[model samples]
Target: MRVLSRFKASTIRRWLLAVGAAAVDPAGVLVCAVLLWLGTAGLCIAMLLVSREDAYHQAIQVGRNLTLVLERDIVRSVELYDLSLRAVAEGAANPSVMSLPKELRNQVLFERPTTARYLGPITVYGPDGTVQACSIETSIRRTHRPDVRWFITQAEKTDAGLYVSAPYASRTAGGKIVLALGRQITSPDGKFAGVVVGRLSIDYFRELLDGLSVGKQGGMAVIETNGILLTRLPYNRNDVGKDFSHSPVFVRFMKDGAGSFVGTATIDGVRRLYVYRHIHGLPFVVGVAPALSEVYAGWRWRASWVALLMALFTVALAAGAWSLMSELRRRQVARAQLQRMARRDALTGLENRGTFDEVSRREFLRAKRNGTPLSLLFIDIDNFKAYNDHYGHQAGDYVIKRVASRIASRVFRPGDHVARYGGEEFVVVLPETDAGSAVLIAEEIRLAIYELDIKHVKSQYGRVTISIGAASSGEPDTVDEAALIKAADMATYDAKSTGRNRVCWHTASNGLNADEHIKNTEPGDQAHP
Candidate 1:
């Protein structure tokens, strides 16, 4: 009985020690659990937001593409109609066509079979808006003369290339809705004669729009520059020629000339993404709208799957914390090692471009906060490509490794950073350094590489050398990383251009002047024999 009692006490003590090591206070465990739940919830919310943004952008792109397609189609159709009008106008002016019999004259002026599909009877109107000739065999004296906007526009604005009128009831086509495209006719002496007009069937546009892939609730529309609805898909006869000036989409279109937006349709109350564009050289705006639900349907499915996987992950993490506490420490160490490897270059063992960017941003923020100066140096090996071609890539790789090592050794300050910008190019970041100090360090780096004495027959120096460009930011709060990099790169190009094996500092005043290049010997330093 005593032995059993001792065993029970030992088991209890081990349990107490495990619980104490895991967390001193029970509230700590509870807090950790609550934090984990919150993290999972936050992750889900972030994913949903990102998904929504992506969907919105995709819808905008689709709207833009659709608008372009519609614009091209409309422009092409109008051009086709204009071609026929010009033909008729020129034919009417010819003495031979006017002398021909009425039947042949009609056939010659208006290709009946071709024009019948898209246009009503081709008519020639006098300056008084009286019909003078028609494609059909009808006496103009008996036909009622109609005074319309197209005839008036053609007579008043003779120089206007093409005149498109508002949609109206067509008398010749049995009261069908149609619009007229008129071209002015002038005598050979440039005198205004009359106008040749072609009535375009609105059904042609309706049919064309119906063939598009816009879903059931989606629509296409044509609006005059004055915010009048000329025509629309789904073809509501009453809505034709209605004033669309009050619509949000129309207001934005008028303001910006061309753009996209999301809004609920006034006609159907369906939410949609609308893209509008002004037709080039025309007084019309074309809009294509697609339902938002259809655009984001795939994204919604993906979000659902993401939510499920995240929930599973949260549960798994909880289980792991309870059962594998000791293994957690080992995994953490491994994760840290992996992260370090990801940020380091494999061959040179220096920080990579990604690491350089991250560290530079952090240092830039620190400098800005502390009101200190920062400098950057861009380094390139001279004639390295030629060396690679002559000595083989292996030797080229060796040179790069050696150069990277030398640069890493020279930048010894804790705040200083070095990175392999790319093949044979290195970047060094120095904190709290002024232009003068940065230039001195660049010269030191140039000398260090010169002393290595790697052979390169293609090089002018007969040994591998480097060119460095240094740029310093006097006020960290004012300058960003991109500006510093651009300045340094330009200075490096200048170093290569003026001479190899030199250091150059960027100066805004003189544009990399000669004074910024460092000579071999400085003040108080002995010249080499």
Candidate 2:
């Protein structure tokens, strides 16, 4: 009886362990399933958006291609018309083709293509828009109404050249649908010859479209401004003669002449994606359509793969987020360090040259606007090269940095900027200070550099010192920043030329404020005698 009770207890413990394991496994699977589902959903949405963008891009590129082809054709047609018009004008001037009266002139002018490559009919018109002659058997005597408009319109306009007329109803002998191309002719002395007009059949453009493929299951159409279907793909007999004025595509093309537009349309009883573009320079709009199924054929399958990858990535990302949080913290610290470095000069801790220039200019303008005196001092180290020679280049750098620190300490106001202009040269801009005060500051800087007592064994001079020039300008309205700098620079040169390690001031007074020399002198500071 004791053994049976022990066996029952063991059986109960085994059953409890099995139940716990089953519960934990299902809970883990449930959490994973949730993450997978969310990731898949997000990937699907992203893929959908990307696919839409791709479709729009493809549509625009195709539209631009169509526009380019049409422009090329238009240019070629104009060139051909130009050549034909010149030929016809030459014939009209020839005495051999000139004997017949104007009515029969067209018939007399008739001649077979001796060149064997002529593509279309060539006709000549008088200045009055009457058909003067033609190579074809057309009745030139009959009032050529279509010829009349193009000739009169182009001849009346002075700047007329080879131009395409808007698609208009043709009244010429062969009254098929047509557009007229004409060129204005003038003699070498600028006398006007009549226009030579050529009729280009629209069917040639249809052949161009037929050769191009937009997408699988895609087709193209060309439409007139009035919504007439001039051509359609697959060479449909019914579409060739029909007008699509009632179509939405035509309505929108008439409204906006450029930019991509998308819509749904029916082709062969199936809904398709339509991308339409308007040709602003032409009299037509071209549109292409691809069946929706073909355009989105692989979209769903690709989306599924993208979703699966995103699911796995999300699981990996979550694990990485927890494990690599320290790296994220490290990146944050690095970004802050970079930002600090961006604003500081790595060589000398003083504000960078760019910062000094900006601040000095602002203060200079402020002092000038208020009619307060502003002064600038340009300082250069004397025989810096000798110092660099005596001690290596690195020692020279230390001397420059030490001198900069000395000058930086002498400036009292926050508005004063001490900047290293270039190697061995420095600048200090003093707002609200006149030439006298600027001279005092320059003397102080000169003394400070001299006090450094940096030994240069290779130098002729015993100790290194700086030569400084001070210029002050009080004429706010008459002075510009460049003039201020020039005055300071000239004073510096004067200081250096007379003697180094000295402060020189430029006085603006002209012995006579002569205009020619006044132009040479700076505001408030006269040239030193």
Candidate 3:
């Protein structure tokens, strides 16, 4: 019972050792690295997406703020123009104001508002679309400006409220494009008598937009809601007064009084982020469009660093995994080599006695349980001592190695075990083999050794040969591993004592007579003496 328990424990321990040896696998490390890389890449992409969204929102906020400031500034400028026009209209309608001297009358008409830079003197055009009064000119220049667009526009409008005209070339302001603000003058009877006008020169808007920076390829613009473009920074003179009613910016993001969007531009196909404010009470929309590339510049820079770091981290991880995997493989190979050295004999490179003992015992128990026979062969190199004395111990050792190789080649069954029993002796354990088969196998091994024909000058045969004693458990239930090895050993002694190169087979039984054990008696089964 104790021996069986020990054998079971030994078997379990060996299996555990085998499992431990397989624990370090390179493929496992590579798989783990790949999973980690996937996780890291997913996280990096998510971070980049979130950061891009944040950048867009920040650009929107910046653009909205800029549009608001511009809107307020524009509103204040228009209010000033309206105030100047009201002053001019009241002066023109009042006889007391007209009766004043030229310089004083001009002061009351436009001097107060003209003190503000970019605000030109108000000009008064009579109902006939002719110039009746001018503040900058010394006298009324009787200018029949009937063909003027601002004059005709004011003449047609019956509403007394302020009117802002489309951008037009000013013959008075050196033909520079100017935006005009006008209001109809009414007589005491409340009929249109004349128009009071103030021209805001392009320099005013140029000065307003000069200090602001949108981007290298981006611009800020003010456009009349009715489709006329007033002005744009990065100013193109040809774009002033251009119709933009069919533009996507006017049709899409121009709704809801205020809006922002990111889209491709129809002009140059460059992508942009547009933020616009339809000045609450005014007819024009103030818009700031920053290049999409500029808006996400910071995010792109930061993402590049983050992606580089992640790539470097992934590379480092891969290198580490590869190095660890290589080290594990190297150790596995070394451990396997050590295990092979531990199990095999140093001289013959075959399973040594210790491994054979454990394997034979296990096979014996297996055969007993299955009711099958087990066989063993004990081999001796005949005349080995004489060969060593005649040649050298090196030749004897060479012969031992050659004999072990022959036995291993012959015992090709997976379950059979060949081992070096001791000096000049070897053992082969043949599982599930009967006495007849064991004797036949032993005869083949003896013949193979005889075929070697190594010189042995001290012996009678003058050649190398081996004696094989093969034994089988005919009654496996009555036999054990010890009895099988003992019987094979006795048979080998019998063969050596009688004649050199021969196979002696024995049917092993516990406590049986040695003579009775030798059952497979062939032609030369006699004692040598």
The best candidate in terms of TM-score: 3
lDDT of candidate 2 over 1-529, digit per residue (tens): 9999999999999999976654344343455555666766676787688986686576567656776676576456546556656566666656566677765665544443222222357777665666666666453546454345666687776864555665554556355556677767565456665677776666666776778876666667777666767676755645654566777656666776554555554335545555566655456677666666666666756767777777687777666554455464565577656654554455555656676677667877898679788888888888888788878899989988998899899998987877777788788888888766777777777877877888866544577877776767763322766677777776677666655777766666632122222222222233332
Ranked by lDDT, the better of candidates 1 and 3 is 3
* CA RMSD, predictions in order: 34.4, 35.8, 5.9
lDDT, candidates in the order shown = 0.78, 0.66, 0.80
Name the lDDT value of residue 281 in candidate 3: 70
Q: What lDDT score goes with residue 504 in model 1? A: 72
Candidates 2 and 3 compared by lDDT, better number: 3
lDDT of 1 by residue, 371-473 (tens): 7888889999999999999999999999999999988888889879999999999999999988778888888788888888999999998999998888877
Off by over 4 Å in 2: 1-25, 86-119, 127-129, 137-176, 184-194, 215-217, 237-247, 254-257, 264-281, 300-529
| Lowest lDDT block of 10, candidate 1 | 520-529
Q: What count of clashes does model 1 give?
A: 0
lDDT for each residue of candidate 3 in 101-215, tens digit (9 for 90 to 100) = 8778776777655446776667888889777678778433447877778788888887888888888877677677888888998878788888998888777777787779998
**Residue 128, candidate 3: C-alpha displacement in angstroms:** 4.2
Which segments of model 1 are wrong by more than 4 Å? 1-43, 94-96, 99-101, 111-116, 138-146, 311-529
Model 1 gets an lDDT of 0.78
Better of 1 and 2 by lDDT: 1
Best by lDDT: 3
The true-versus-predicted C-alpha distance at residue 499 of model 3, in Å, is 2.3
Ranking by TM-score: 3, 1, 2
Residue 514 error for model 3, in Å?
2.8
